[model samples]
Target: MLLALIEDSLEREGWKGVSPMEILEILEREATLRRRGSITPNDVRSVFREVKKARETPVLETLRKNLTFALPKLPVSRHKVKMEEFIAASKNMKLYSDQEKSREIMDAVYLIRPKETRQQIGGLHEIKDRILNQISLAFNPRMAELGYDSNCRFLLLGPPGTGKTLLALVAAAENNVAFIKVRGGELMSGASYHGEPERRIKELFGLARQRSPCILFLDEADAIFWGGDATSNKLLAQIKSELSELTSKDRIVVIATSNKEELIDRATRDRFEPHVYTVPPPQDDDEWNEVVEIHLQKIKPYLAPDVEGRKITRMFRRERILSPRGVAETITEAHRLWASEIAAANEVRAATDQEKRTVALARFRADLERIEHMLPAIK
Candidate 1:
């Protein structure tokens, strides 16, 4: 069990493999093991030598010979020395450090690619500028020298599907920092079931610190921080305290989003009020068009060859406002339609530009109409 836990910790620490020495160090540092007894690195080396010796013992060789007759078969290492080499190579791998931990967090988070940077997002110009400025100040070396370690926290307030999450992603990408996303709803639900709200808070911030200079985005911020009375309120207050402590850690920038700013608890709002930015739905047709155009360009490569952008944009904007997510969905549906046409034709040749446009436009129009009616409030 100890060995399994050590391996698990090593894996979590971004060590795909380990040397005998590393294994020993990991075991010694393991919380599970440290609580029970003292285990030193030197002791680990001694154990490694013992295990190597035991594997090569004459008694083990004799037992191996008898085991063949005692059972159907037994799987055993043919070269015990190979284990030593494997362990040595692992020790040569990158040491576990903040950089390695950051890489692991980057892999786990939903990385916002370069194309999805602030440039791709339409409107929200004020919010975008504010975020970029904060990022600039945070990245500046002078911040540390001046001891101006203010929490670079921002709260995005808006209605659902108003691009709050997208803004967070774009900010992370533009700043060239690791992105760490968490849903407040999930944390709150888990806490309710297990009654470990404080621990959950610690874990979230701990990960952000491990991957310092990263953007920690908490979506649905209101869900976990608001809407609780007496009993649940105490838990909410405790969670808030945990967050309050993290405010001093300038390396981790927290961007939290909520559908309704009012729904956020008064205490929570006051805590993060100075940096809150309201993200409203697209205010006009021009903004909406830009959102559609952004998504259309992304799906264009898969679209019928040489389809005119104007026609596609017109069809998507027949008569409605679409959130960034809605636009993405619409384009995705159109791609499916184009793919289906190709599948049904079973032709060796690709469809002509006109054919692709016609088929895709028709499919997109249908899907858009259905989706608009079904989820009108989302946009």
Candidate 2:
């Protein structure tokens, strides 16, 4: 149990940066709370080694399968635990079980406690404000007393990598609610038996309601909601029925994203009508500069003094890196290149900060040029 707990903690996004002692402390605390007995420093060290070995060995497949099989059987005084408590514990440990039959209804959905607030998202000021308002209206307890509608739904329309998904995450983060993400493809693919797809959809909504004051984000919504076949129609109907059951008092907000809005039928689009927001690429110089700065801030220390935010923004425009995701990828690749060069140089002799910065700027420009050639020409 301690090994699994430690492994789960290490798998989480920012937890890899934590020190071994800190991880041990956390494991000790969790174990003590669960009355599973105290975890010693040596125990944590051994488990860490095992975890590393498990990752490197081919037996990782068997280990994962065993973990999945054992998760539902987690002893609770020899009695079955409530689903809500089970899921809450899973979330606390960041254990996303996509294999358990008992949890198959929620297998396609994952819960996220988003670290990105509205302030963290760059550009789309108007859209951000509107989303924030909608979240406030849906989550604020006082709004219901004042006769304001709390049933908020949003359909974020945008080109690929234009921050549509990021906006949904920010909405949940800003409201301090559970972010339940469902990829339409995964949701649809999970249904094997007849009527299973419709049943999964209904149960998904039920799970959302149970975890209320949450954001039910359906990413790439057209993948499942696009009506064509009999199964697709049934799944769509189930979603619509579940959506209708949501009243103003329910703090659950449904946010869907689609790059190709035309693929979704008019009836489905009408459900999110008047609440649809288009997330376009950064339109103005200020927006572009802000985006560049936001993405480049991580590597700012290695950037040359002359590598201004506007200069990066201009490079992005020149390279036709229109999406925020494109800009981020370019910056990340450049930084990786710069760091590798610096590391290689350090083996020979320690380099000055000025040398590092100069190398970083050079790599950034080189990457931008390479990306320019790679991107398809705009019609």
Candidate 3:
């Protein structure tokens, strides 16, 4: 009842959103509800102050973000912002003093790249067109010339294992900007000395600004930004808070991805309107067929004869074409098997004094057939 009264007081004050103090209060309440130990008062005081400073920190940093999507759209010229300026600006904010933690974050950012960068990233012609179109439409006229508008916010929603995260890496590489990725599970830094999710959220946005023009991609976006998870409300608050600040005058941008859209908080959903949705490789979509072919074409040349035989045989005998991801896996497995067989054949030849390519070829073919049976049928 005490907690309810406090929430009501905030609501009555027109605090439609949660504030740093409110968040701290909620954390204390939650700990009690769960019968967990209480949050330390010292930690609460420290993190709440950090939270206040984070208020002025930019979230959108670019006019193209969803927070400002309703504002007049403008044409964006092609230009990339320099990383140095971004880093210098972050230092001004004094957000990241822990260089070690920042490096760890950056590593995760790089590691999130798609396994097949060339094939997946380069082949996204239509998607690129859509993304560029939005960037053009969403930028501010003057900022576009200054490269601020070049930073864009995009929300990618689609089936599982799709290259949503991979697309982020490709975009970063193509634009030559830092790629930073944050997942819902890893957002917390074990609570500050104050136990608020405050410190990490502040650090995250600060890191993003430092890496401005960079891709801040999230894998399970719904988990972080959706309503219903009292835990997620903190992040949801951070998103609105950041975007509001970024719109005033900054060049940083943000992009997010989620497989489940329905679970997203209304505020987050509103912010990502007009987002691009990535559909799973269609059952019979011609475009998907072409993408599949292109992916296979690139991998075909160096298939190592044994792997080439196994994969090609499976593909030719079966009617289904693998998703770009699936095809890549199939090729890798085929290569390993082929390499093993060649090694065995070379060893046997030392004793038998017989070098026969025909027998080896037949064995590879049989292996291919076995592989064909193991693959699940794609619809």
Clashes of 3: 8
Q: How far is candidate 3 from the true structure (C-alpha RMSD, Å)?
A: 19.1
If scored against the real structure, what TM-score would every candidate get?
A: 0.60, 0.66, 0.55
Stronger candidate by TM-score (2 vs 3)? 2
Query: Mind giving the per-residue lDDT tens digits that candidate 3 earns over 1-379?
Result: 2233434434443333344334534544443343322233333333333433343235324544546447553333123322232223222322222332443343333222223343554244557557644543443356656655343557787766555666666555554444566776565434434425554656566656543444566667776677665556666787767655654133444677777878877777666556646645434344455554555566576553554333453563384544546655665675667666555445434434233444544555544444444432300
State the lDDT of candidate 2 residue by residue for 1-379, as single tens digits.
2333455545542234345334544544454344332233344444444444433355555567677554232121222222233223322442122222235555576665687966657798767787778767877878888987765778889899988988888878777776788888888785778899888787677667655667899999998778888887887888777777776677788999999988986677778767888899887999988888998898888998888999889988998998999999999998987676555443323335666656644545544344444332310
Tell me the lDDT of candidate 3: 0.50
- In model 2, which regions exceed 4 Å deviation? 1-103, 190-192, 348-379
TM-score of 1: 0.60
Model 3: residues >4 Å from true position, as ranges?
1-126, 132-151, 189-195, 283-285, 303-322, 350-379
Model 3, position 249, has a per-residue lDDT of 33
What's the CA error at residue 368 for candidate 2, in Å?
Answer: 19
* Model 2, TM vs. native: 0.66
List model 1 lDDT by residue over 328-353, tens digit each.
78778878876655443333123367
The positional error of residue 62 in candidate 2, measured at the CA in angstroms, is 46
Q: Candidate 2, 52: how far from true, in Å? A: 37
Best by TM-score: 2
